[model samples]
Target: MNINDIKMVGIDQNTPIEIRERVSFGKEIKKALLKFKETYNAEVVILSTCHRSEIYVYSENIALKTIKDFFIEYFKVTEDELGQYLYILTGVDAVKHIFRVACGLESMVVGEDQILGQVKNAISISQENFASGKILNKLFRDAITLGKKVRTETGIKDLALSISYIAVKFISDEFKDLNDKKAFVIGTGEMGQIAIKNLISKGTKVYVSNRTHSKAVDLKKIIPEIEVVPYDDKYVQIARSDIVISATDAPHYTIDYEKFIKVYKGKKICMVDIALPRDIDPKIGEIEGVSIYTLDDLKKTADENKKKRIGFINVIEKIIESAVNNFVNWFKTLAIEPQIKNINKFADVISEIEFERVINKLSNIDERDKKNIEIALKRVAKKMSDLMIKHIKNDIINKKYEEVAIDFIDENGGNI
Candidate 1:
């Protein structure tokens, strides 16, 4: 009941978008899960995204065929047509595949954040039907925890995290309250536009500061209330604004503190410096109430996390191993449940025969004693039923259910 137990099947982006969209589990996923569960008797987990659609089930090739049959039957597909693109993973490979996906290693854009939430939502509906078993529950829970850790401990963030988002966080942390603040960004670069968009969305008033006042004036037309401060009065403009984001391409440092200090007579302000060969001085970081982020410092935390995602393989293995143990043990019980019911059916037949034989003898005993005698017989039958189930469960785990079933079927098939 460990990692060696359950089987898996995988499919990738190689399939046509038409086929992939047809199989997507978003809008009508519940309907598909219900059909898969009722028709195939599968403990199924389906992961569908832009890059791949994988099916993981706690069944062998026979069970897998039943699932494939359901898909073909549902889609009305011929065997040859279905054969074009599908990847199947069984045993340990299936276990590892899910771990990688939850960890974000298998994404079309690696380390993208949205897939984890999508995985959780799919499992939730499966559980609402009172259908999900031990395997999926363990795999998904472990995946979520591992994803959070990958973000927290690794420098992978520098390589993978969004640049616009990092800039937003830096601005908010530097300026305690920007509610009443007015900001100015000098350039019309993409980064400059992104910075302005983020600040305004957070309720800060913005002014465009540039040498060609026409571009700044044009920007003011789109944002009607944002005042356009003329570039000639740049130092005076810096004195008037609470936040300044300098992203201009000037030959020298655009805002040297020597000339710029003349306007600042110790007022609270913030700066967002995001230009190459540095728009702002590194030593300016030492100025009172002044802070700076060189290009390297901006994404340092994300860069530190790159290794954590790689090492997460071991942690993922451990979680998947634990999940497999629970799945196999539960699957063993699933196999035994039907055998237990059959044994009950056999005992009921035996009890009926004895009852018919004793019907005439029931008149000899007092009515009360006869009733008690019947209850005792029923209890005896129930006890025997319990014992047989426990014994069969043990036999199944030892891989002897086939022989037991063969004998029972041989004896019962013709008569039943």
Candidate 2:
């Protein structure tokens, strides 16, 4: 359970969205984690979202460079191309990074709630794929707990920022009024649904298109006024929309530039692509009277939202720091558990042996007297063992026993 065994290689808000999109695990995240396990025989979890792609590995056999090289080879990107964008973290740094991320401090929109779920999903997928082991399982579970705690105890959620919310806000800011605007949202996933609700709340008429029409219909059921456009005819609906937002997990461009150009009447449409791989083509932004925004473009709105939550940063950071220290201390305590168990076992064996010897020597000892003597002997042994364990733990906490009193156990011939 050495902290050094945990390492993270990642690129977050600092990296370019295009680069992130190229490296995202997407639908293959579970597969990639499985492959990581097969290759390194280590615990690994991949957290890929629109804003970041992180690989967390827990194993003495795996180096950060090994994971970096794995990324280069897996993403098929050259070293120079990927090297400059990566952030490598180890030990406590890695621990703090995950905690910060789970708490949404690392998000472009600080305190965004989506990332918490994404973090949960990342570890869950790894667990389901048998890719995450003891350390990561504990690490992620602790992170999730801290995430919930921060959200519950802090005012960071007052910022009320998310990719979906910000995407709509960005568009609403552009138009100044969304009361009568027509919004065509592609996809009915979490992001898309949130975007649709945001649009509707802005007094805008919302039309949704999904590959699964029933999902769109499901949205319509929630908001009867919401219209469901057939997925195949989404381009036609886009032509009539004042604003179009795409938030889907599709691999390829959902709205191709050429196809969009054919339907685009140059009527001044605002398109927001909140998808990782980018649902809308980048080239569409070049067309006159057509404005496009992606996850990267939402940074301006995120910056504004960050100002609103600046005061909460310190509070959130304190919570995260406390959680990180707790996790580290837990790992430290876990490291010496075997030694503690051995000591307790040794004490019990010696107490039982001495108790039998003394009781055997007593001629008129009743069952009650023998029981009291046995209890006294066991209690003495337990107290001694507890004191020794307490000192060992203090040594561990003080950084005075890196090998965790293993030498003492070895000297005692602890085969018992």
Q: Which residue pairs collide, candidate 2?
A: none
lDDT of candidate 1 over 145-196, digit per residue (tens): 6666564555333344444445655677777666768887777665776667
TM-score of each: 0.44, 0.63
Task: Provide the lDDT at 328 for model 2.
Answer: 85
**Candidate 2 Cα RMSD after full superposition onto the native fold (Å):** 11.4
> lDDT per model, in order?
0.64, 0.85
Off by over 4 Å in 2: 161-308, 333-337, 354-384, 401-405, 412-416
**Model 2 scores what on Cα lDDT?**
0.85
After superposition, candidate 1 runs with Cα above 4 Å error: 1-5, 12-22, 60-62, 69-85, 108-113, 138-416
The weakest ten consecutive residues by lDDT in model 1 span 155-164
Error of 1 at 4 (Å): 6.2
TM-score of 2: 0.63
Name the lDDT value of residue 403 in candidate 2.
72
The numbered model that scores best in TM-score is 2
